[model samples]
Target chain A: MNGWLLAATVELGGAGAAALWGTATGPLPRRVMAQNLATSAVCPALLLLAQGYGRPSYVDLALLMALLGPVGTLVFARLLADELLDDRPRAWTLTWAAAGLSAAVVVAVCVATGPSRAMVKLLLIGALLIGGNVIASRALAGGFRGVRGA
Target chain B: MADAVIVVALLLVAASATAAVAQREPARQALVLSVLGVVLAVLFTVLQAPDVGLSQLAVGSALTPLLIMLSVRKVRRQARAKDRAR
Candidate 1:
């Protein structure tokens, strides 16, 4: 296996283990935070795997993940708002860390792929991943309180 | 070894699935289930089937959790309303 595959394997294994453990045994807010982290953690691994496998088409998986993962978190945040309002899960460090990881992965992949349509696609996925992650985290922290009962 | 990634993905899927089953609360189970979906998608991709992974991500990550959570909310709301009526 090459460096890309090795990196992907390590990141996936480490992040996946932590996410599983956190989500499985935790309070409501912590579990929600872990669920959010899972999306961010897995998206970069997916990108790395796409690069490692030498299949540009596989990047679509990452794109879908970047788009949907946060939606899942938002669903939990909204649905579990009652339970979470008091605690307000705010893992800004973890959120920024995952965002930074996605940014780093996307930049590395773009550099490897050079300027092209694929680079643009990679950038889009990165933006969506980070932006959605932040938004979902905000919602989890009860940033959008107006929508709580609605 | 290239197979290392696959092994890791498989282990993740196994662990997450077990976690999903072990969770007692419906809400917590939904959270675990969402993570399970993402891990399973990664497993599918590692197995050289991005097509399946794509669909799994689409369904497992967001849709399944939304459905489960909505149902849980609805059930709880109805129960609460019934208690209030008495």
Candidate 2:
């Protein structure tokens, strides 16, 4: 787990540097690359933290991350699409709000629960969170052609 | 024996991950990630998680990289179209 953690930390550091460079250059590909690297680095770090401290409850971090990863990528893609399709702030704003709220809720739940039953609950809750998102996305897509398929 | 395999696997995984990001070609990047997945799967096997190893092999090593490659191809096609339009 430490090994995984260390690797993730190193990758995160690399990604951070890349992000800085990307920001400076303002290249869309560079920005996408940085975001992808950062998100990928996160999952392993969460896994490591969960294992290292014996706080299996940190699995919630992983669970929340599973939800966030694709969403973050899509959000970035959506933002990119805005630049190409039409410059619009509304899509980005909504994605940011949704991502932020879910992340906050996951962190709050993780902090509130103790290690044992908390871990199990975290897994269950995290599954439900992701499950709900998938269902909602599917429903929205089916309901409206404007929603755009995920 | 197991410990040795793990150390080697870890090294390979690290190398693969680095190569994935470092490579200029998208196809090479995908290939490197696939290699990393395979190395990690072996490490998982050594750790006695055959289930995980199987999933890694199925999803990470095989499915994911394939999908990534396809996405890359699509992106490349789009870029070519954009260039042509310009």
Candidate 3:
């Protein structure tokens, strides 16, 4: 369809493949890391889809992804903490790359949207996506001392 | 073509679902299942059903895995308790 949709397709496909592979056959830590990256990847793609479909309402899905994707990863971090005690899963490169992509997508979408309430919403989703991503990554790497299991 | 995304989404769902089934451990299965949920949500979106996709994101990304992991943890704790009692 449109370029935005096309970009969404490529991003979803590429990131989805890497995530599936990483999670399907690896150590538990790697699997969790893959899950976090997948969330980051999927959120931006959802935003792109919303822009491509010309449906501002669809943006809610991306917002939800940005909000909840990290929640899922954090769930694993908390529940699997004892299991992951010895090995900390850290993927700053992939995490930062996904954050940058999301930022790019948000900026592009805002420029296309011009000065409007929708642009502000897009900015909010971007912040949530990147912020949640970092938090989730930090959780997986055992960054928060309070988060360690008893 | 417009169909490429649809095709990609479909293939991801199929592949991830199969992988979910293939996983040997419940924890690992839960992990794969989470990925499947996200894939399914994207598939729904690509098919022009963001409503379904939205709900799927809510349930699939976090809720389902949380439920599964909690259940697994409970069962494991019960088993350990029984072992200690013996």
Candidate 4:
């Protein structure tokens, strides 16, 4: 029990470290970014591999996060870079529209499947985590921009 | 396990902070931070917190460097702009 709490706390620290590190660095070299992004995406599968011994609840949650994390990072990078849009605004907009449409379809599928309560909760939590991150990041960027504008 | 992890966490955090200050180049700083992150992840794994460790390894050691590189590019750009202005 205490181990769990400690793990959770350390996890928070890890996440905070990542966020701070990322914010400090900005976007990395393209190859490095792509490699990191690929590794980030693969982390979930790696975690799933651990479940061969026993099915841990957190493993499921991690898998969900793994699915979303890289995608979110890539999307956020694209949005922040804004060059894609800058170069071809219509194409960028259409791509985002399609991505959003696909996401909606995935969500509909999950709802239709009537997943287990734990899975549903995990999904909701994952969404909240992603949404919260987006909001917090935007707020932070906005604050920085304001400071710079001043 | 818990106590050990806590100790390691404190140490890693200290290392990270120290590295951030001690490192001069942006690339070197990124590397230090990645090392610190790996240490933290290992600490978590030792504590039977594979999930947390995995996430840390992913975000900290991997994604974080990429982000830093981007910022480095921006800073270089600004520096060039300043040089041009001069």
Query: What TM-score number comes out for model 1?
Result: 0.98
Local accuracy of candidate 4 as per-residue lDDT tens digits, A1-150: 243344344444554355345433543332223222322322322232223224445454344444444444443334344332232211223223323432343354345446777447445544543443343233323322333310
Candidate 1 clashing pairs? none
lDDT values for all models: 0.92, 0.47, 0.92, 0.46
Q: How good is the docking of model 1, by CAPRI class? A: high
Model 4 regions lying over 4 Å from their true place: A1-33, A36-41, A60-68, A75-115, A121-150, B1-47, B51-63, B70-74
For model 2, give the TM-score of chain B. Answer: 0.84
Candidate 4 chain A lowest-lDDT run of ten: A83-92
Query: Candidate 2 residues A72-144, lDDT tens each?
Result: 4444344344332432212233333334444544454456455666656665645544444443333322322
**Candidate 2 structure quality by residue, lDDT tens digits, B25-60:** 665455446445544654565455646755665565
- Residue lDDT tens for model 3, B1-86: 88998999999999999999998899999999999999999999989998899899899999999999999999999999999999
**By descending TM-score, how would the candidates be arranged?**
1, 3, 4, 2
Model 3 chain A scores worst on lDDT over the 10 consecutive residues at A141-150
Stretches of candidate 1 exceeding 4 Å from the true structure: none
Docking class of 2: incorrect
lDDT string for model 4 (B1-86, tens) is: 43544564566567566756776777646645654555565456545677787777677755786688678767878999999999
By lDDT, is 2 or 3 better?
Answer: 3
Q: What lDDT tens digits, residue by residue, belong to model 1 across residues A88-107?
A: 99999999999999999999
